[model samples]
Target: MTSEKLDRRKKYTRMVLKDSLLKLLKQKTFSSITVKEICELADINRSTFYAHYQDPFQLLETIEDEIIADMRKYLHTYNLQEKEDALRMTEKLIQYFSAKHEELQILLNKSGELSFERKVRHVAEQFMMNKMTSEEKNTHLPEYVSKFIISGSIEVLKIGYLRDVRNHQKKWRS
Candidate 1:
Protein backbone atom coordinates (compact mmCIF):
# COMPACT_ATOMS: atom_id res chain seq x y z
CA MET A 1 0.00 0.00 0.00
CA THR A 2 1.03 3.59 -0.57
CA SER A 3 2.22 5.61 2.42
CA GLU A 4 -0.92 7.73 2.32
CA LYS A 5 -3.16 4.66 2.34
CA LEU A 6 -1.05 3.15 5.12
CA ASP A 7 -1.52 6.29 7.21
CA ARG A 8 -5.27 6.22 6.67
CA ARG A 9 -5.41 2.57 7.67
CA LYS A 10 -3.44 3.29 10.78
CA LYS A 11 -5.81 6.08 11.73
CA TYR A 12 -8.82 3.87 11.15
CA THR A 13 -7.31 1.09 13.19
CA ARG A 14 -6.54 3.43 16.04
CA MET A 15 -10.09 4.79 15.99
CA VAL A 16 -11.52 1.27 16.06
CA LEU A 17 -9.24 0.23 18.89
CA LYS A 18 -10.11 3.32 20.89
CA ASP A 19 -13.83 2.81 20.50
CA SER A 20 -13.59 -0.82 21.56
CA LEU A 21 -11.44 0.02 24.52
CA LEU A 22 -13.89 2.63 25.76
CA LYS A 23 -16.74 0.16 25.46
CA LEU A 24 -14.79 -2.37 27.49
CA LEU A 25 -13.85 0.24 30.09
CA LYS A 26 -17.49 0.84 31.00
CA GLN A 27 -17.74 -2.74 32.19
CA LYS A 28 -14.22 -3.44 33.47
CA THR A 29 -11.29 -1.69 35.08
CA PHE A 30 -8.19 -0.80 33.09
CA SER A 31 -5.97 -3.32 34.83
CA SER A 32 -8.19 -6.23 33.86
CA ILE A 33 -8.07 -5.28 30.17
CA THR A 34 -5.69 -7.21 27.94
CA VAL A 35 -4.27 -6.78 24.45
CA LYS A 36 -5.89 -9.98 23.26
CA GLU A 37 -9.31 -8.87 24.53
CA ILE A 38 -8.98 -5.47 22.88
CA CYS A 39 -7.90 -6.97 19.58
CA GLU A 40 -10.81 -9.38 19.70
CA LEU A 41 -13.21 -6.57 20.46
CA ALA A 42 -11.77 -4.40 17.71
CA ASP A 43 -11.66 -7.35 15.31
CA ILE A 44 -8.04 -6.60 14.57
CA ASN A 45 -4.91 -8.68 14.80
CA ARG A 46 -2.67 -8.51 17.88
CA SER A 47 0.08 -7.15 15.62
CA THR A 48 -2.15 -4.25 14.62
CA PHE A 49 -2.85 -3.44 18.26
CA TYR A 50 0.88 -3.61 18.99
CA ALA A 51 1.55 -1.32 16.03
CA HIS A 52 -0.46 1.41 17.70
CA TYR A 53 0.29 0.69 21.38
CA GLN A 54 2.92 -1.22 23.29
CA ASP A 55 0.28 -2.32 25.77
CA PRO A 56 -3.22 -1.60 27.03
CA PHE A 57 -1.79 0.95 29.46
CA GLN A 58 -0.52 3.00 26.53
CA LEU A 59 -4.03 3.02 25.14
CA LEU A 60 -5.31 4.17 28.53
CA GLU A 61 -2.80 7.01 28.43
CA THR A 62 -4.08 8.04 25.02
CA ILE A 63 -7.64 8.01 26.36
CA GLU A 64 -6.61 10.13 29.33
CA ASP A 65 -4.81 12.58 27.05
CA GLU A 66 -7.91 12.96 24.92
CA ILE A 67 -10.06 13.55 28.00
CA ILE A 68 -7.58 16.12 29.35
CA ALA A 69 -7.48 17.91 25.99
CA ASP A 70 -11.25 18.07 25.98
CA MET A 71 -11.26 19.33 29.55
CA ARG A 72 -8.69 21.99 28.66
CA LYS A 73 -10.94 23.16 25.87
CA TYR A 74 -13.89 23.29 28.22
CA LEU A 75 -11.69 25.08 30.79
CA HIS A 76 -10.20 27.65 28.44
CA THR A 77 -10.87 30.25 31.14
CA TYR A 78 -8.69 28.52 33.71
CA ASN A 79 -6.51 31.22 35.25
CA LEU A 80 -5.14 30.61 38.73
CA GLN A 81 -4.12 34.21 39.27
CA GLU A 82 -7.62 35.61 39.54
CA LYS A 83 -9.69 33.96 42.23
CA GLU A 84 -12.93 34.71 40.42
CA ASP A 85 -11.62 33.24 37.20
CA ALA A 86 -10.44 30.13 39.03
CA LEU A 87 -13.90 29.72 40.56
CA ARG A 88 -15.38 29.70 37.10
CA MET A 89 -12.79 27.15 36.07
CA THR A 90 -13.68 25.03 39.05
CA GLU A 91 -17.34 25.13 38.06
CA LYS A 92 -16.42 23.99 34.58
CA LEU A 93 -14.37 21.14 36.02
CA ILE A 94 -17.25 20.06 38.25
CA GLN A 95 -19.54 20.07 35.28
CA TYR A 96 -17.09 17.99 33.26
CA PHE A 97 -16.76 15.41 36.03
CA SER A 98 -20.50 15.25 36.65
CA ALA A 99 -21.11 14.64 32.98
CA LYS A 100 -18.50 11.89 32.99
CA HIS A 101 -19.12 10.69 36.53
CA GLU A 102 -19.01 7.03 35.66
CA GLU A 103 -15.65 7.27 33.95
CA LEU A 104 -14.22 9.58 36.55
CA GLN A 105 -15.41 7.26 39.31
CA ILE A 106 -13.55 4.41 37.69
CA LEU A 107 -10.43 6.54 37.54
CA LEU A 108 -10.62 7.98 41.06
CA ASN A 109 -11.80 5.09 43.17
CA LYS A 110 -9.65 4.12 46.19
CA SER A 111 -8.57 0.88 44.58
CA GLY A 112 -5.18 2.53 44.06
CA GLU A 113 -5.51 1.35 40.49
CA LEU A 114 -6.36 4.83 39.35
CA SER A 115 -3.86 7.24 37.78
CA PHE A 116 -6.17 10.20 37.24
CA GLU A 117 -4.99 11.89 40.45
CA ARG A 118 -1.53 12.25 38.97
CA LYS A 119 -3.10 13.39 35.73
CA VAL A 120 -5.23 15.94 37.58
CA ARG A 121 -2.16 17.13 39.51
CA HIS A 122 -0.33 17.54 36.24
CA VAL A 123 -3.23 19.54 34.86
CA ALA A 124 -3.27 21.75 37.95
CA GLU A 125 0.49 22.38 37.64
CA GLN A 126 0.07 23.28 34.00
CA PHE A 127 -2.69 25.71 34.87
CA MET A 128 -0.48 27.25 37.53
CA MET A 129 2.43 27.59 35.14
CA ASN A 130 0.24 29.22 32.54
CA LYS A 131 -1.02 31.79 35.01
CA MET A 132 2.25 32.58 36.83
CA THR A 133 4.90 35.10 35.89
CA SER A 134 8.17 33.83 34.45
CA GLU A 135 9.90 34.40 37.79
CA GLU A 136 7.24 32.46 39.71
CA LYS A 137 7.33 29.67 37.14
CA ASN A 138 11.09 29.44 37.44
CA THR A 139 11.02 29.36 41.23
CA HIS A 140 9.76 25.90 41.95
CA LEU A 141 7.57 25.62 45.02
CA PRO A 142 8.65 22.92 47.45
CA GLU A 143 7.05 19.58 46.57
CA TYR A 144 5.05 19.42 49.77
CA VAL A 145 3.77 22.94 49.31
CA SER A 146 2.87 22.20 45.72
CA LYS A 147 1.01 19.05 46.64
CA PHE A 148 -0.61 20.69 49.62
CA ILE A 149 -2.20 23.26 47.36
CA ILE A 150 -3.04 21.29 44.23
CA SER A 151 -3.80 17.90 45.74
CA GLY A 152 -5.87 19.46 48.49
CA SER A 153 -8.03 21.19 45.90
CA ILE A 154 -8.36 17.98 43.92
CA GLU A 155 -9.29 15.91 46.97
CA VAL A 156 -12.01 18.38 47.89
CA LEU A 157 -13.46 18.25 44.41
CA LYS A 158 -12.99 14.51 44.30
CA ILE A 159 -15.08 14.03 47.43
CA GLY A 160 -17.40 16.91 46.75
CA TYR A 161 -18.28 15.21 43.51
CA LEU A 162 -19.97 12.45 45.47
CA ARG A 163 -22.34 14.96 47.00
CA ASP A 164 -24.11 17.01 44.35
CA VAL A 165 -21.76 16.05 41.55
CA ARG A 166 -22.25 19.56 40.17
CA ASN A 167 -21.98 23.13 41.37
CA HIS A 168 -18.43 23.41 42.68
CA GLN A 169 -18.24 24.93 46.16
CA LYS A 170 -15.16 26.94 45.43
CA LYS A 171 -15.97 29.57 48.07
CA TRP A 172 -16.16 26.96 50.79
CA ARG A 173 -13.20 24.94 49.53
CA SER A 174 -10.92 27.82 48.64
Candidate 2:
Protein backbone atom coordinates (compact mmCIF):
# COMPACT_ATOMS: atom_id res chain seq x y z
CA MET A 1 0.00 0.00 0.00
CA THR A 2 1.09 3.59 -0.61
CA SER A 3 1.93 5.69 2.46
CA GLU A 4 -1.36 7.58 2.26
CA LYS A 5 -3.37 4.40 1.80
CA LEU A 6 -1.59 2.76 4.70
CA ASP A 7 -2.37 5.75 6.90
CA ARG A 8 -6.01 5.66 5.88
CA ARG A 9 -6.19 1.93 6.61
CA LYS A 10 -4.64 2.48 10.03
CA LYS A 11 -7.15 5.25 10.81
CA TYR A 12 -10.02 3.04 9.70
CA THR A 13 -8.79 0.18 11.88
CA ARG A 14 -8.52 2.43 14.93
CA MET A 15 -12.02 3.78 14.31
CA VAL A 16 -13.39 0.24 14.08
CA LEU A 17 -11.60 -0.71 17.25
CA LYS A 18 -12.91 2.37 19.06
CA ASP A 19 -16.47 1.77 17.89
CA SER A 20 -16.27 -1.86 18.98
CA LEU A 21 -15.00 -0.92 22.41
CA LEU A 22 -17.66 1.76 22.93
CA LYS A 23 -20.37 -0.72 21.97
CA LEU A 24 -18.98 -3.33 24.31
CA LEU A 25 -18.47 -0.86 27.14
CA LYS A 26 -22.19 -0.16 26.96
CA GLN A 27 -22.83 -3.86 27.60
CA LYS A 28 -19.93 -4.88 29.91
CA THR A 29 -17.19 -3.51 32.14
CA PHE A 30 -13.78 -2.92 30.62
CA SER A 31 -12.30 -5.61 32.87
CA SER A 32 -14.84 -8.15 31.59
CA ILE A 33 -14.05 -7.41 27.95
CA THR A 34 -11.56 -9.57 26.06
CA VAL A 35 -9.56 -9.38 22.87
CA LYS A 36 -11.81 -11.97 21.23
CA GLU A 37 -14.85 -9.95 22.16
CA ILE A 38 -13.31 -6.79 20.75
CA CYS A 39 -12.27 -8.44 17.53
CA GLU A 40 -15.67 -10.03 17.12
CA LEU A 41 -17.44 -6.73 17.75
CA ALA A 42 -15.04 -4.82 15.54
CA ASP A 43 -15.33 -7.45 12.80
CA ILE A 44 -11.56 -7.42 12.55
CA ASN A 45 -9.04 -10.22 12.94
CA ARG A 46 -7.00 -10.90 16.08
CA SER A 47 -3.81 -9.92 14.34
CA THR A 48 -5.28 -6.60 13.31
CA PHE A 49 -6.39 -5.88 16.87
CA TYR A 50 -2.95 -6.81 18.16
CA ALA A 51 -1.31 -4.67 15.50
CA HIS A 52 -3.17 -1.66 16.91
CA TYR A 53 -3.55 -2.33 20.65
CA GLN A 54 -1.97 -4.74 23.10
CA ASP A 55 -5.29 -4.99 24.96
CA PRO A 56 -8.60 -3.30 25.66
CA PHE A 57 -7.08 -1.23 28.49
CA GLN A 58 -4.61 0.24 26.02
CA LEU A 59 -7.49 1.13 23.76
CA LEU A 60 -9.23 2.79 26.69
CA GLU A 61 -6.10 4.85 27.25
CA THR A 62 -6.24 6.00 23.64
CA ILE A 63 -9.86 6.98 24.08
CA GLU A 64 -8.99 8.92 27.22
CA ASP A 65 -6.16 10.62 25.35
CA GLU A 66 -8.49 11.65 22.57
CA ILE A 67 -10.99 12.99 25.12
CA ILE A 68 -8.33 15.04 26.87
CA ALA A 69 -7.04 16.24 23.53
CA ASP A 70 -10.46 17.60 22.68
CA MET A 71 -10.79 19.20 26.10
CA ARG A 72 -7.38 20.83 25.69
CA LYS A 73 -8.35 22.06 22.26
CA TYR A 74 -11.35 23.83 23.77
CA LEU A 75 -9.29 25.23 26.61
CA HIS A 76 -6.72 26.50 24.16
CA THR A 77 -9.37 28.48 22.36
CA TYR A 78 -10.45 30.19 25.59
CA ASN A 79 -8.85 32.77 27.87
CA LEU A 80 -8.03 30.80 30.99
CA GLN A 81 -6.75 33.87 32.85
CA GLU A 82 -9.65 34.10 35.26
CA LYS A 83 -10.87 31.93 38.11
CA GLU A 84 -14.39 32.02 36.67
CA ASP A 85 -13.14 30.43 33.48
CA ALA A 86 -11.71 27.50 35.43
CA LEU A 87 -14.90 27.15 37.45
CA ARG A 88 -16.98 27.22 34.30
CA MET A 89 -14.74 24.61 32.76
CA THR A 90 -15.23 22.38 35.78
CA GLU A 91 -19.00 22.89 35.58
CA LYS A 92 -18.89 21.99 31.91
CA LEU A 93 -16.95 18.87 32.79
CA ILE A 94 -19.54 17.96 35.40
CA GLN A 95 -22.26 18.40 32.83
CA TYR A 96 -20.33 16.22 30.44
CA PHE A 97 -20.06 13.54 33.14
CA SER A 98 -23.77 13.88 33.88
CA ALA A 99 -24.51 13.21 30.24
CA LYS A 100 -22.34 10.08 30.29
CA HIS A 101 -23.68 8.79 33.61
CA GLU A 102 -24.73 5.46 32.15
CA GLU A 103 -21.44 4.79 30.42
CA LEU A 104 -19.48 5.99 33.43
CA GLN A 105 -21.52 3.94 35.87
CA ILE A 106 -20.70 0.81 33.89
CA LEU A 107 -17.04 1.64 33.27
CA LEU A 108 -16.31 3.22 36.65
CA ASN A 109 -18.71 2.08 39.33
CA LYS A 110 -19.26 -1.47 38.05
CA SER A 111 -15.78 -2.18 36.75
CA GLY A 112 -14.27 -2.85 40.21
CA GLU A 113 -11.18 -0.99 39.04
CA LEU A 114 -10.07 2.58 39.82
CA SER A 115 -8.65 3.08 36.34
CA PHE A 116 -11.47 5.34 35.20
CA GLU A 117 -11.11 7.63 38.20
CA ARG A 118 -7.36 7.68 37.76
CA LYS A 119 -7.72 8.59 34.10
CA VAL A 120 -10.24 11.32 34.90
CA ARG A 121 -8.07 12.76 37.65
CA HIS A 122 -5.03 12.61 35.43
CA VAL A 123 -6.80 14.53 32.71
CA ALA A 124 -8.14 17.12 35.14
CA GLU A 125 -4.72 17.72 36.63
CA GLN A 126 -3.17 18.06 33.21
CA PHE A 127 -5.81 20.57 32.23
CA MET A 128 -5.12 22.64 35.36
CA MET A 129 -1.39 22.45 34.88
CA ASN A 130 -1.75 23.66 31.34
CA LYS A 131 -3.85 26.59 32.48
CA MET A 132 -1.73 27.69 35.41
CA THR A 133 0.47 30.75 35.27
CA SER A 134 4.15 30.32 36.08
CA GLU A 135 3.78 32.23 39.35
CA GLU A 136 0.76 30.18 40.35
CA LYS A 137 2.65 27.03 39.50
CA ASN A 138 5.53 28.17 41.68
CA THR A 139 3.64 29.01 44.87
CA HIS A 140 0.45 28.53 46.97
CA LEU A 141 -0.31 25.18 45.29
CA PRO A 142 1.74 22.04 45.38
CA GLU A 143 1.84 19.67 42.43
CA TYR A 144 -0.21 17.09 44.32
CA VAL A 145 -2.97 19.61 44.98
CA SER A 146 -4.40 19.11 41.53
CA LYS A 147 -4.67 15.38 42.13
CA PHE A 148 -6.33 16.08 45.44
CA ILE A 149 -8.88 18.41 43.86
CA ILE A 150 -9.67 16.04 41.02
CA SER A 151 -9.96 12.98 43.25
CA GLY A 152 -12.05 14.86 45.80
CA SER A 153 -14.40 16.15 43.13
CA ILE A 154 -14.70 12.66 41.68
CA GLU A 155 -15.44 11.19 45.11
CA VAL A 156 -18.13 13.78 45.69
CA LEU A 157 -19.69 13.07 42.32
CA LYS A 158 -19.54 9.34 42.92
CA ILE A 159 -21.28 9.72 46.25
CA GLY A 160 -23.91 11.93 44.71
CA TYR A 161 -24.52 9.43 41.95
CA LEU A 162 -24.73 6.56 44.41
CA ARG A 163 -27.26 8.37 46.57
CA ASP A 164 -29.39 9.38 43.60
CA VAL A 165 -28.62 12.95 44.64
CA ARG A 166 -27.41 13.75 41.14
CA ASN A 167 -30.93 14.57 40.08
CA HIS A 168 -31.23 17.31 42.71
CA GLN A 169 -29.76 20.51 41.30
CA LYS A 170 -30.01 22.24 44.67
CA LYS A 171 -28.02 19.50 46.41
CA TRP A 172 -25.38 19.62 43.72
CA ARG A 173 -25.15 23.39 44.06
CA SER A 174 -24.53 23.02 47.78
Model 2 scores a C-alpha lDDT of 0.68
Model 1: worst 10 consecutive residues (lDDT sum): 80-89
lDDT of 2 at 91: 56
TM-score of each: 0.59, 0.59
What lDDT would each prediction earn against the true structure? 0.66, 0.68
Model 1 lDDT tens row, 50-109: 878989888877877877776666556555335444444445555656676655555555
* 1-174: candidate 2 lDDT, tens digit per residue: 245446888998899998888888877777788999888988899899999888888998787666656555554554355654456656555555566555454455544667666766666666666667788788857466666656666666665473354467557687
Off by over 4 Å in 1: 1-8, 77-86, 125-174
**Clash-forming residue pairs, model 1:** none
